[model samples]
Target: MVQLDATTQEVLNRISEEFAQKGAYNLRQNGVALCHGDSEHIKIRKKEDKPGIDILIDGDTKGERVFIPVVVSVSGMTDLVYNDFYVADGADVTIVAGCGIHNSGCNESRHDGIHTFHVGENANVKYEEKHYGEGNGTGSRVLNPVTNIEVGRNSVFTMDTAQIKGVDSTVRETNVELAEGAKLYVLEKLMTDGEQKAESNIEVCLEGSGSSAQIVSRSVCKGHSLQTFHPKAVGRNKCHAHIQCDSIIMDQAHVGSIPEIQAEHVDAAIIHEAAIGRINDEQLLKLRTLGMTEAEAENVIIENFLS
Candidate 1:
């Protein structure tokens, strides 16, 4: 079995100590990874193959929290999977997950992911995710992600995702769940350029009275690429939901946002909003009139928007 580097080993050690202080936990070096907690049914596996990195998450844990670290580099083509990390009843847990790619080597890559969360009554969970890519290579990337959440009465679940740049990339997915007397919030962002494309399908269904859900999304597409965002909200009796998506386009780039709202009960209230547009040409002309070159004008806009 291959061992982790000194830096990774130190990180594992720190997490293990933290687990011990909470009592009734164990930590050990598994083949190619580290394991923590006395979790029997839960499993995290990482494998390296020609296509790229492969990860597997199985079952739920009874612990207070669960943590997993993933790193992958693909010079050719790759595909990956992320199973849902389950949260036990009346237990609070946090899942911090991130993904990065060696954009220079790989010609193409795709990420296939699914997250199933079981929120117990009166429990709370915090989930965060980050995705970024780099390299000058020309290829295509597809990210298909699905999140299934079941929130018990009076529980809370929050999910956030940040996606950086990619060329000729496409992302599509769905998020759905049932919340009773609880609350759910989702925040997502995407940035892209150069023939890139991203599509996301999001939906939230409220089944419990007094339950609420909010969805917020922002995106930027530049250099002839296309970006699309679709968000839907459905409310039942005495439930409420909100959905919104915003986007900016540049240099023949294209962006589209679709927001849908459905209220089945008269007691329910739902709202949906969407907006997409490109930078102002007259503003750039004004910059040029002020002695700034065309290139400089565009650069200024990018710096102001991204920085």
Candidate 2:
């Protein structure tokens, strides 16, 4: 692994210790190491106007594990991109990605990120991603991640992701394609508590026989911020798809959810349901009478519904 700065190196060291304690698989790329079967710190490196890293498949027929942690300290019109992560046949892999930014005082600091993954036949992959940002500058950070997953026959994939408040972020899209007998499970979550904008777009396709996909999403929008969720799932012949999205609004915030499911074949079964509403005053009043303040009551609603 490349030697990291003190702060990042400490995160990596902690992950390494956890790996030893849990007996997990270790993955190394360009000297950077990550562990499977155990959680590890995300890998973050500074890339000046270029693709950060690319993973390729060769020689080995088995899959590999990867961990990515990104810290955006760039200021003044910065750009960064990365190539796709490749997974080969008859193997299983896991990826844990984390993104965050420091308190840069620049007014025009922004970051753009892209991640792509390819899954091969009979392979299984589990991916988890988290985004966090905290700063007091007028500069806003943007995150546009593209997840291109091609699941081969009998392959299984799962995704769990969460986005926190601070800075403006929009996930352009999450596109998934499944092969025969492939299965996928996805959980998308977002929580906003700042004076920023947030949006998420996710799409899944069941393109082969016996393929299936499911999505569960929860969102919370507060303050003067706005949020939107657009989730779509498509099922072809003999395929199955399901989607569920529920949201809660507070503090005069605005939220919109559009969930749709499309199935073309007679043997296919697709279902979608979505609901958007605000925290009722009746509920808040009831909680306030129970020794909770207005802010506390609203927080309870957010935690129970969104978290």
Candidate 3:
């Protein structure tokens, strides 16, 4: 196990709490990496040619699921990390990864991460990631992330990502490809306050027979924040795809949801839906009847809606 200072530990704890990370984990501060875990079924190693780590899950592994958590905390610096994951056939694993910025410096802090996943036949993978920022300084906290996923035949992949608060700006892009009998599910949640801005673009391709993909996005924008969500699903064969986007905007906040569904084959099927609005008055009034203040009631409603 690697020892961490008080400030770094606090950042890790926040990341853990937000993403529900437990058990085996890895921590990276500034640009240094520290990892601790069992090596029998899960292997984590730094990449000699890159600035990040590689996680490998052995083949034919079952029973207890493997968990890998990664955290990055830095201030007044731009950090870049590249993570590659390989899951062998019939393996099941979960990964929790996030980044937090603790900036009390004069310069802005930022993090850019690229993640790629290779899932083998009959494997199942669940991945979750969250981003947060906190500081009393005048520096901006920015994050940009790119994800690429490839799932083999009969495999399943689920990805959940959330950016709850404290980020100044972020742009996220995700691309996924599914083989025969493979399934991909994506859930994206985001909340932005202050003058923060966020943009997310996701594309999924169902290229094999029996392949399916679904994407659901939820977002809340407050205090002049701006957000945009674009999710596209393409079916190239006898497959199914669906996309849904929902958002809430308040206090001059702006949000846009654009979903595209394309069917390239006669047997392909695709559907999409989008909705954007504010807090429901009935929901708020019902909460207020419980002796809560207006602000408190709104908060409760928003939390429930996002959850």
Best candidate, TM-score-wise? 3
- The sequence of per-residue lDDT tens digits that candidate 2 reaches over residues 1-307 is 3344554443333333222213223332222333223323222233345555555443243344455555555445454556466666766666666555543565554445577777777777888777666656667766666677778888888998877555576655788888999999988778876666777788788889999988889888877778888888888769888898887776767888877788788888998888787777798999999999998998887777656
| Native-referenced Cα lDDT, model 1 | 0.62
Name the better of 1 and 3 by lDDT.
Answer: 3
lDDT of model number 3: 0.83
lDDT of each: 0.62, 0.67, 0.83
Per-residue lDDT value at 115 in model 3: 91
Order of quality (TM-score): 3, 2, 1
TM-scores for all candidates: the values are: 0.73, 0.79, 0.94
Pick by lDDT: 2 or 3, better one? 3
Encode model 3's per-residue lDDT on 1-307: one tens digit a residue. 4556777677767766542223445566776766445446787778999888888888755643443334444557888889899889999887777888877766789888899999999998888887888887788888899999999999999998888879899999999999999999998989999999999999999998999998889888999999998898999999999898889889999999878888899999999989999899898888888899999998887787778
lDDT of 1 at 12: 36
Which 10 consecutive positions of candidate 2 have the poorest summed lDDT?
Answer: 15-24
Worst 10 residues of 3 by lDDT: 17-26
The root-mean-square deviation over C-alpha atoms between each candidate and the true structure, in angstroms, is 6.8, 5.5, 2.1
Error of 2 at 25 (Å): 12
| TM match of model 1 to true structure | 0.73
Cα shift from native, residue 167, model 2 (Å): 3.0
